[model samples]
Target: MLLHPPSGTDRVQGLAARLGCTVAEHCEPYGKFKPAVLGSLSGLALTLKEFGGRWDRVERVYVFANWPMLEAALEYCVRNRDEARVSA
Candidate 1:
C-alpha cells in the first residue's frame, strides 16, 4: 500500500530481506497493492535504519499480508503522506 516515489521498489525489497521478510512484487486484483512483503521481522534490526532513522520512514519499508493488513496499510500510508504534505 505504500506509494513509493518513482523507483523505491528494489530498495524496499532489500530492506524486507534484511529484516527476514518474503517479498512478493505483485498482487492481482488489488494491483494497487502490488509488490508486497508478507510477514514481519520486528526482532531483526530494520534495514532502513540509515534512512533518517525515523520510525515512520523506516516503517514505510513496505510489507503486507492478507486483505485487512493491506487495507489498513493503504489507509495509513495515504493519511500519513497527506499529513506530511499539509505540514510541509
Candidate 2:
C-alpha cells in the first residue's frame, strides 16, 4: 500500500502501522526538476525501483493520496495496467 497522507497529519500513521503498510515521508521540494519530482508519485516509483527484481513480481498497488498525487497514480496505473492491479 502506498499512502500519501496530507501534510502535517499523523492520523494515518497509526492506521498504517496497524495495517502493516510502509509510509513514505518525503521532505524534498517539488517542481519539474528531477530532485523535485521525487516527492510525489515519482517517489513511489523510486521506492519500487529500490526493490529491483521484486518490482517485476509486484501484482497489486494500492494508492491513497490526493489531487495531483492521485492523478499521477492513476496515470501510472493506466500505463502499466497489465502488470498489476492498481487501486486508488
Candidate 3:
C-alpha cells in the first residue's frame, strides 16, 4: 500500500497505481494487499513511544516500517501545528 502522506498522497497513489500495486491507509481484508515501505525499525519504535503520549496534537502515517517514521510524523504535526490540520 502506498500511504498518502499529507505532502504527496496523490502522487504516491498515482505512482502505486502505475506500478500495479494497491495503496491504502488501512490494511483491507484481502490476500493481495501490501503496506507502503517507508522507513527503518529502530527509528520507528522510539518515535511511536514518544509521540503516543501526545496524541491530541499529532497525526501518524500508519504505513511505517519503523517507530522513527511514526515519531517523525508526530514531530511534523508538532511543527506544522496547523489548526486546519485538526478538525472537529
**Best candidate (score: lDDT):** 1
Task: Write one digit per residue (lDDT tens) for candidate 3, span 1-88.
Answer: 2334443455444443433333344333363322342333233334444544222112232344433444344444434434545752
Clashing pairs in 3: 1-34, 2-23, 43-68, 44-66, 44-67, 44-68, 45-67
TM-score ranking of the models: 1, 2, 3
Give residue 88's lDDT in candidate 2 (0 to 100).
Answer: 36
What are the per-residue Cα lDDT tens digits for candidate 2 across 13-51? 433343333334332224211101111233356543332
Give the 10-residue window scoring lowest on summed lDDT in candidate 2. 31-40
Among the numbered candidates, top TM-score falls to 1
**lDDT (0 to 1) per candidate:** 0.42, 0.34, 0.38
Give residue 79's lDDT in candidate 3 (0 to 100). Answer: 41
The candidate 1 region of ten consecutive residues with least summed lDDT is 47-56
TM-score of each: 0.31, 0.26, 0.25
Model 3 lDDT, full chain set: 0.38
